[model samples]
Target: MIKAIQNIFSIPELRRRVLFTLCMLAVYRVGCHVPTPGVDAQVLAKFFEGTEGTLLGLVSAFTGGALERMTVFALGIMPYISASIILQLLAVVFEPVERLKNEGEQGRKVLTRWTRYGTIFLSIIQGTGIAIGLQTMRGPAGEFVVPDQGMGFILLTVITLTAGTAFIMWLGEQITERGIGNGISLIIFAGIVANMPAAIVNSVRLLRTGALTPLVGIAVLVLMIAVIMAIVFMERGQRRLPIHYAKRVVGMRNYGGQTSHLPLKVNMSGVIPPIFASSIIMFPATVANLVDVTWVQTLASMMTPDHWLYNVFFVALIIFFCYFYTAVTFNPVDVAENVKKQGGYIPGIRPGKPTADYIDIVLGRLTFAGAIYISAVCVLPTILIGEFGLPFYFGGTSLLIVVGVGMDTASQIEAHLISRSYEGFMKGVTLKGRHG
Candidate 1:
């Protein structure tokens, strides 16, 4: 590992890219600390103390506690992510969007522009909603979260948060274009990771104060390590389908006689299922806070993170999105067609429709198993929090994102090193990405 680190810096371009990515992340962390104007920081913090089961708490996790602090970056890059997901869904159902997807690089550029526009629009709406929500929020001491709630404060907050998100979007683009790894995912990874130290400190403090029993603390530590190991193993696991390419004569030379395997990851959907599940399960609570209906509030209260109903819905949604997102992203028919075009066929499977069918069946089974794994991982943390009262900052979704993103970034870094005639982090072993 030390030699690999040295190798990375030995390559000037790689070093520059790594440094650039670090600088951009530093900027994001800095923005997380810059408070939004007109909000009472103490009151906002106190309000967040009781929002662990609410949408605000979930959003705060992604924003690295910026939302809890009412910072300029309280919105984080969620609106951008929502926009991207919206575009992806549209591409599946909308003809124009599908055509645009099929148009190659130019089409991709157009779609990206559309996503940016959608981000801005969503940011405005979300920012305005947050502003309105703040006006009615009170701390545990009955202090208003917003010191001066007015149209002026609302407009200023909307503008500030919108601009912050726009800036983050730009930073992500820059990192992707000029730095290393995925900018957006890395930004989120950084945010989740930034809170780890605080969580650890709090846990230690609790342990010392006898608030957290040593047995429970040790169990939490063991669970965390075990969970991380499980995640790493599953994320790298793949089902390799054998493929045989028939020998063909091109002019006087034989070509196309080759054997390869198509690798389908155990978790093709990655963290999307958990994220979508969280959002969908938390939607009622978010809406309840906005709407003043009695039944709605009751429904929201019943759907807290610690509630069994919430867990059921959360698991169901995770399973649903695992299949849905996998279907949207991976088309067995397309893969079959591409393989056929290259004169390759899966062993024991006929080319064309049969191949597609076979692949789809395998994928469906894998997706089901993946869904189960994701649900277990995500729900286990909630169980711990509810039953043991542990501070689970490193929740299941956060773990998945951190591990998945770390693997991808390391894979990219390894590729760069190998391309430059340097050894990767591990000798004689290649790191496979999530898609593989």
Candidate 2:
């Protein structure tokens, strides 16, 4: 392990990319501390203290507690993510977008421009809502979040948060272009990890104050290690579908006799399903807060993180998106067509529509199993904390994102090393990239 660490820096290009990624992440964390105008930090923190079950709590987690601090980065990269997802869904349903998708790189640049515009628009809308909501919000001790709330403060807040999000989007693009791993994923990963130290401090404080017992602490530690192991196992797990390439005669020379397998990862959707599910659920919570309807408030109250209704809906959404994302990313028809063109076929399946059908059936089963596993992994931590009284930090969605992103980044680093014919952390063994 130590040698691998040294080997990373031994390669100058890989070392530069890694260092650049780290510097960008440090900038993000610093932005998390710069507060926005017209908000009382103390009152805001106290207000979020009791909102653990609300949508804001989850949003804050992704923002590295920027929401709690009312920082310039309070809105985080979520608006950008939401905008990207919206455009992707539109590409599927809208004809023009579908056509544009076929245009390749140029078309993607056009769509990316559109996504940026959408992000700014969402930032303005959400910033306005949040500004108004803060004015009406009071801490548990009757302290107001915003002392002077008006159009001026609202506009200021909107501009600050919008600019912050836009800068973050630019930063992510830079990282992806010049650094290692997916920039957006790394940003979110950094945010999630930023809270780990504080969570640990809180847990240790609880133990010292007698709020958490030694046995419970030990149990939590054990469970966390177990959960981490499970995540590593599941994330690395894949079902390989064997493919045989028939012998081909080209200019009296034999070719195309090769054996390979298509590997379908267990969590094909990765942390996307949970992230999408959580983001979608936040809409209702945000609406319920902004609009003062009696019935809506009552319904929203029932959808808290601790509520059964919320968990059920959360699980359902995860499963739905699991299948949805898998479908979007992997098209069996295309795969079958490509395979047939290359003279490859599944051992028992025909090389036309039948192969497509076979692949679809296999994918369906994998998707279903993946959905269940993701749902269990995400929701189990909540149950452990709520019912069994575990610590604040547990391996669930956050852990999944952390582990998945870390492995993905490391794999990219390994690829760069291996392509240069240098051994990496995996030694002589090849580390598969995220898509692989």
Cα lDDT of model 1 by residue, 1-436, tens digit? 8888998999999999999999999999999999999989888777677677677778899899999898989999999999998999898889999999999999999999999999999999999989999999887777888878789999999999999999999999999999999999999999999888998999999999999899988888888888889899988888999999999999999998899999999899999998888887887887775577999999998898888999999999999999999999899999999999999999889999999999999999999989999999999988888876787657679889998899999999989987877778997675454444
The whole-model lDDT of each prediction reads 0.90, 0.86
Candidate 2, residue 298: how far the Cα is off, in Å = 3.7
Error of 2 at 288 (Å): 5.3
Distance from true location, Cα of 424 in model 1, Å:
2.3
Number of the top-ranking candidate, with TM-score as the measure? 1
What TM value does model 2 have?
Answer: 0.91
Alpha-carbon runs more than 4 Å astray in model 2: 141-143, 280-294, 427-436
* Overall local distance difference test of candidate 1: 0.90
Model 1 spans > 4 angstroms off = 213-215, 288-293, 427-436
In Å, residue 301's CA in model 2 sits off its true spot by: 3.9
Candidate 2: tens digits of C-alpha lDDT, residues 1-436: 7877887888898899989989998999999999998898888887777667567888899899988899999999999998987887887779998888889999999998999999999999998888888889987787788899788988899899999999999889989999889999999999999989988999999999999999888988887888788888888988899999999999979988899998888888888899888877765776675577998888888777777888899999999999999898788998999999999999989998999999899899988988998898888877877776777476668989898898999889878876766667865575444444
Ten-residue region with minimum lDDT total, candidate 2? 427-436
Candidate 2 residue 389 C-alpha distance from true site, Å: 1.0
